[model samples]
Target: ALTTMAKWEGGRAVDARAAETGETPLMAAASAGQLDCCLSLLTAGADPLAVNVDGVGILALVASKVSQGKRSKVRAVVRLALLNAAPQLRVLLLHHEDCGRHISFKPHQESPERISAILAFIAKGATIGLFSAEELLVSTEFDQASKEHLIRCHSEEYISVITQLGEQVANTPVAFTPYYQGFKGLPQAKQKKAEFSDTFFSPGTMAAALRAAGGVVHAVESVLKGHSRTAFVCVRPPGHHAGVDGATAGAPSSGFSIVNNAMIGALHALEGNHGRLCKRVAVVDFDVHHGNGTEEIARAWHAKHRKAGARAASGADESDLFFASIHLADDGAASSIEFYPGTGTRDDLHHNIVNVCVPPMWIGAGAGGRGSVSA
Candidate 1:
């Protein structure tokens, strides 16, 4: 079967479906209890995740054959599909020595200690068989993102200034204006000096930031290349707050973020070297504070693609990149204090942007917050 399939133009032939039923060759083989033929089709690049006209997947079709008591035959086909479908989960972790050990700002709520606690919890879960070791791929070593990758979501000058400041923090406190002026020039030095006050930086910050951004990039590429169906990237100096120019949503600082890693990864997947691997991508951010930087970047990406006459993957007028931010909103009461960054309102929506703002005092499903998000 494998030899015959090779002569039929490979994947195109193996995945060909019936016009009336929308069943691929793999589905037909599984339905007929031809285990050998199913294996051959999978090896020839048949997609096991393909569905029929009723939207029933190949695995369900194979499992249905078990009702005929062909139990062993059904099991064989299911195992083969699972192995070929890349169903394993990939978890990307930053190296302990590389992740910044000095970014311990109390307000930011992120530190080396927090990462250690999270890792311990995940390790405990894995030990108890919450997930099998065979199904979990944990990678600690990954390439640091280059200047080009960082510049995709940030300005070259901002990148340079931040890099210099991170290095200078070793010899001088971030409070030193003269040292910062030496790198950024006198005119912009004062403004840049004040921005760093909100976010702490150390000698290890540059390395940690690069690695964090790189981990996200690697995760995106791995999923697109079919190495894994899903991936979770665990890195530090949280993104989603840093915009193209570093500060976001008129915030006084970069919102404790040095670079926008998520936007960089999204753009990388959308605009690969050979061609785009993904025509449409969505970033759904559910955080206490609004992801102003992510929203800004998504808006810009849509505008750029729209200007170039590029339509969405669904052939809609909306941009290829869709961003939805669900975050806490400030109440209109006189005594109500505004939240951090204070953006992402219902009125701030765009064609591809969804800002679902939940009031600070909102509680339970009875509240309209859930409905706003659902809509």
Candidate 2:
């Protein structure tokens, strides 16, 4: 019922308070140890600070009930509600240390530069009173994603290969694939050769990748549980280029990406890792490059379960996975948007995928035959 109300598009006001008592829906839920109900109301824009006739807020009532059986759950509800009640939406910022150390010659694309720039932007926002530092909960403490979790979104073969390559990098600091050897092979005299690709991994790369994946999963849980309405996972090496197809799907050194962080997090959400069942999930990728890996993971999982659902009437069924990508087209065709990986197109649209094909330079139509430009 709460989900239906949340999805309702009609703008009709629902009375949150009673005629005489003035208690809110949130207060009632919190008082009863109904964490889910509290979350639902919070998602629907319920004012967490709504007070009753006695002048006690919903949070106070929830705190008063913390000594009950569902102590932790009630406390979590109160914390999440407090966060939501803030004037500005609280933001959780997570990053791994290895992200900042992963330097590259790719100018603005380097890990340290990019991560530092983002931190600076956040600091600026805080300094300007846009949001308080407490609202921006920054953390580096996240468990590394386990192999069991990784296998859920990636092929066994890909996982094995990436693991081997990461081990090699740890042991020897240099490894060779069919095309080229990683950075350790390049000498100080060969500075130009090292600038060729930023995707190469070192010994610590896998740990960083796992932590990055972990941060995103944690963020998703935080948001879904009403802990925070927003979270930003800032980590590198980037994973959108590391997908489930071609030679790079599971390869640790593919496109400067080691693990598909987005897909891993999505898998966690679907699997109810945080104890919340997400029947329908959508991954919107705004990266400049197409999120082929995320697309592959979502589609393949959906198809696998869908086939099982048809055969065994009572088995695990497929959940709806919506994958949308707005990025540079891979085709050189004269057409406005020529999709690569051949998965996203108007004719080939799936119930789960929506591809918005647009030209590289054509940044939407504007007045007077002018178009806004972006890099």
Q: Top model by lDDT, which number?
A: 1
Write one digit per residue (lDDT tens) for candidate 1, span 89-158: 2333334447655463344566766667777888898799674344456778688888877876787787
- Candidate 1 regions with alpha-carbon error over 4 angstroms: 1-13, 18-40, 48-81, 84-97, 100-102, 105-108, 171-198, 304-318, 331-335, 347-351, 362-375
Off by over 4 Å in 2: 1-89, 101-108, 170-195, 245-253, 273-276, 310-316, 335-348, 362-375
Q: Clashes in model 1: which pairs? A: none
Question: How well does model 1 score by local distance difference test?
Answer: 0.67
Measured by TM-score, the strongest candidate is 1
lDDT of each: 0.67, 0.62
lDDT tens digits, residue span 1-375, model 2: 984674366413223587788987777777766767777776677765466899876655665555666686666656565565553346778887866654433453545677778888989997996755666778887777888678878777667766776666543233222323322243445333444544555666676777777888888887776566568998876776566632343332355666788878877777754453466678888866566666667777777877665522222245456777776553434344444443332312443665565445643443112112221
TM-score of model 1 vs. true structure? 0.73
Reference-based lDDT, residue 318, model 1:
43
**Local error of candidate 1 at residue 369 (angstroms):** 3.7
Per-model tally of clashing residue pairs: 0, 3
lDDT of 1 at 278: 74
